[model samples]
Target: MKAYFYLLFLIFSLTSHGSYGQRPTYSEDEIIVKTVTDEMDQVFKSPDFLKKKNKQFQDITGTMVVDIGIIQSGKVATFYKVENTITNIDFINFVSEYILQHKFKFKLPKKMRHKIRYSITF
Candidate 1:
């Protein structure tokens, strides 16, 4: 009897996960990227992106990966493990700080953990 119950639980678990994998409407990564882009625009659209550069200034370009944690309350509670960035530390900190301070327009699913990479050229 115990063995039968375990088998039943396994099948149910697999089927439920399979359902979540299908995203005929806006894959999770797509939603995450869109949300990040929109949030970043709210800040970087100012003089920040269009600031005049000095001769010594160089544009930094690379993809930055961030680990985000969303709580069941429909809000982001953590942003960490910034990676794949090959720019100055100041720039990385600036980007990371902006991400943490700004809220994504989309409310993530309950108890969701997401990671995404965004290209930066500035």
Candidate 2:
């Protein structure tokens, strides 16, 4: 009976993990990118001081989409996967921090934002 139980447990574990093999996992960067983008959208909609500041920096108006990997301790491990023409690193870094600090308010679209896994994108 013990041998049979062990075999059953092995089979169950294998089956459970087998289905997950086909799925893709998100890196840390992907999570950060999504977090930032969603936060920015939310901040833009709410009437607040940040919105005014965002507007004031109109020169940095171009969309900056970045893939960032943030650890649980809130440290950014990677910051190079940005997909934008803007060269203002300071602003991008500031936005990244802002996103991390605030709770995400915007509900991301299922199709477009669903790709984000463990990382965030802007």
Candidate 3:
């Protein structure tokens, strides 16, 4: 049993800090991340985000991905990257502003900050 536990710990230690294929550098931060929760569904659908919607473009319809960074205080500080294939400034701004208004349900431990990737269909 002790050997099994030791092996498990070894696996976790080796994999925890290993980044595959040039992942974003979080070396300086002692981050603890959890999957986005059901509460985020409400945040995403809330009136705050809906109010910024622009339906002016009939031809543009797809998923927009954003990597949002949140400080340990649980507030979204910045969007590291926005993946809009069409490069629509208005749509990007709408999403970015909407995300800034919301906070993550999960709080990082040890006052560490982290980033999360999310997508919304337009």
Off by over 4 Å in 2: 1-40, 49-56, 68-81, 105-122
Counting clashing residue pairs in each candidate, in order, gives 0, 16, 0
Q: Among all windows of ten consecutive residues in candidate 2, which has the lowest summed lDDT?
A: 113-122
- Candidate that scores best on TM-score: 3
Give the per-residue lDDT digits (tens) of candidate 3, residues 29-109: 333333443445567677754554544444556777777787765678887556666577776676677678776544555
What TM-score does prediction 3 earn? 0.56
Clashing pairs in 3: none
Better of 1 and 3 by lDDT: 3
Q: Which of 2 and 3 is ahead in TM-score?
A: 3
Q: Write the per-residue lDDT of candidate 1 for residues 1-122, one digit (tens) a residue.
A: 99999999999998888766443323377776676566655556556644622222357766666665544343456767556656577766766665566545455554555655544445
Q: What does candidate 2 score on TM? A: 0.38
Q: Over the full model, what C-alpha lDDT does candidate 2 score relative to the true structure?
A: 0.51
Give the runs in model 3 whose Cα sits over 4 Å from its true position: 1-37, 54-60
TM-scores of all models?
0.45, 0.38, 0.56
- lDDT by residue (31-74, candidate 2, tens digit) is 64666556556665566735654665556655565554444333
> Sorted on lDDT, highest at the top, how do the candidates line up?
3, 1, 2
Instruction: Please report, in order, the local distance difference test score of every candidate based on alpha carbons.
Output: 0.58, 0.51, 0.62
List the candidate numbers ranked by TM-score, top first.
3, 1, 2
